[model samples]
Target: MIRIRLGARGLGGVRFAVSPVGAAKDLLRLVGFSPGTLTPQWRTRATDALSRHRLGLLAVVGGGGPLGYAPDFIRPEPPAFLTDINTGLHQIATTPQERIRYELAGAVNGHAWDPGSGHPPPRQLLRALDRGEDHFAHRLADEMARFWHAALAPSWPVIRARLEADVTARASEIARSGLAEALNRLAPNLEWRDGELLVHMRTDSIHQLTLDADAVILTPSVFVDWALFCAGEPPGAPAPRTPLIVYPAAQADCLPPAQDHPLIGAMRRKLLAELSQPRSTTELAQRLYLSPATASYHLQILHRAGLVTRTRRSRHVLYQRLGGAT
Candidate 1:
């Protein structure tokens, strides 16, 4: 059995066990918050209200409802709108995603409720809160943009007024939260220490480790161990006992393909060579002396051409070439 422990440095001695799922649960527990099941009915209620308010697109993609807690782990593929909003928020906020989480209590939801003790400085708190509210407003703007682009493309009036009202209300809620020192500690906290498992958490997912029972537990942070596990490979080749099945062939007409620019053609050739084994866009880009984004964009084009395929292995997307597709 794997054993893990965590320590709180200040505000008196406090400790918690590190579970297999990692630190998100412990962090939430410290704040007296527990995860709840996100049921379809609750989703329907929120979606319905959102639709009525013309915020349906944002709500659906953003994921709201009774099970809105972190561990509920229901984040859909964030719509491009949400992604762009999150990117902008990250650029603007000091803490980014951690500052805006809300919870239900005292008949009304409270912003930045901390069951865990300790207060930050009043100025920092205010800044964090302001950043949080700004992040939320940007998210709302993205939703409005999408809604306007699709449902009301020809008109400016439908989304403009609603966008104004939503932003106003969101901003007003930020004002009501009070810029007090204690009120601002509601953001999730992260700590790393020696001899304690450090589990790096992203979004709602736990980073996992695949250490052998006899292997040394060198790192206290689960995240460190998780990284080690990812870096290690399993022993031995595939068993000969494994079966392979050949599928019936389908006919296709041979046609001349559109020509690619010289740069694009060279990039595609490099990608095909690199994809003989799965490799992340970043790694491939580094090897090819290309920027990560440029590599990724070209990889997508290669993917469309059936020269490559991508699978998400952990946080990285790994690309592989189809053996005979080209």
Candidate 2:
């Protein structure tokens, strides 16, 4: 069975009905980081704060192939952040001696592969998923098993399994008690929705919470992309953002003739038209049929061209078509 859990040490709660791939992708979204193969730097960057907060970790695990059950799992409720249960799991699952045992066990079956060990790193695993590349997922699953075996089993499971259980139990009680009362008394701006079970941050505030979940599982680290949404200005307040694409107006004499640059010319026209109406990365990506990264690249080129300027309104950066020469 693909067991998934999302909670910290003392407070356990969030649960979800998702596939392993979905869980992994969701976690990646939360942390504001890209996924693909592995990278040396990724280990340091993703886990640094995890080390500090020692705050605990949440997991979303699932399996459907021969090794997993098919019932599908879902988080009946949202979890409260109290302690670091998942991180505690990592300590046991990723330790040296334990990792060695799991690695060798898998290696004997000719399955010992580490996506993060070689170049390209494992983030590509996710990149491939984004592109709908099937082979990549198969290859990733094969290697992912080995990676998890080495990184999370024997070594990390020892401590993680125990802590996760405790956290999950307490979280359930806290949620049953109606957290809004304590939450409001502590910080008035937060709101908890019955359906989504998410603690909505109405203002610039930080508060601790406890909650419950049905199943609990742990992944290695947090996904880094959620920051773009969670840390931004309050919802409905024009989400601030910088221009993703800039282009010099061909009519302006300063920019080199646009006759030779169709890409630049097209972008210039589009930016000019959109100058009055702001669009988000997602909207722009859909409109242009380009990946967010590709859109960002085009935007960077435009910024360098000086055809557009950026401004910060609250936590968001907005782009404006500037009347200037490149």
Residue 145's lDDT in candidate 2:
39
Worst 10 residues of 1 by lDDT: 240-249
**lDDT at 173 for candidate 2?**
47
Question: How do the residues 56-139 of candidate 1 rate in per-residue lDDT, one tens digit apiece?
Answer: 324322332222222111111111211232343333232223323321121013112223323222242234346555554455
**Candidate 2 RMSD to the correct structure:** 21.3
Q: How many backbone clashes does candidate 1 have?
A: 8
Per-residue alpha-carbon lDDT of candidate 2 for residues 125-229, written as tens digits (9 for 90 to 100) = 234435432333233344333333332332222222223333343346456765434222221222334422233322224222233333222221222211111
Per-candidate TM equals 0.21, 0.25
Off by over 4 Å in 1: 1-253, 256-264
Clash pairs detected, candidate 1: 196-220, 197-220, 197-221, 197-222, 198-220, 198-221, 198-222, 198-223
Q: In model 1, how large is the Cα lDDT of residue 104? A: 17
Q: Which stretches of candidate 2 lie over 4 Å from their true place?
A: 1-132, 179-196, 199-326
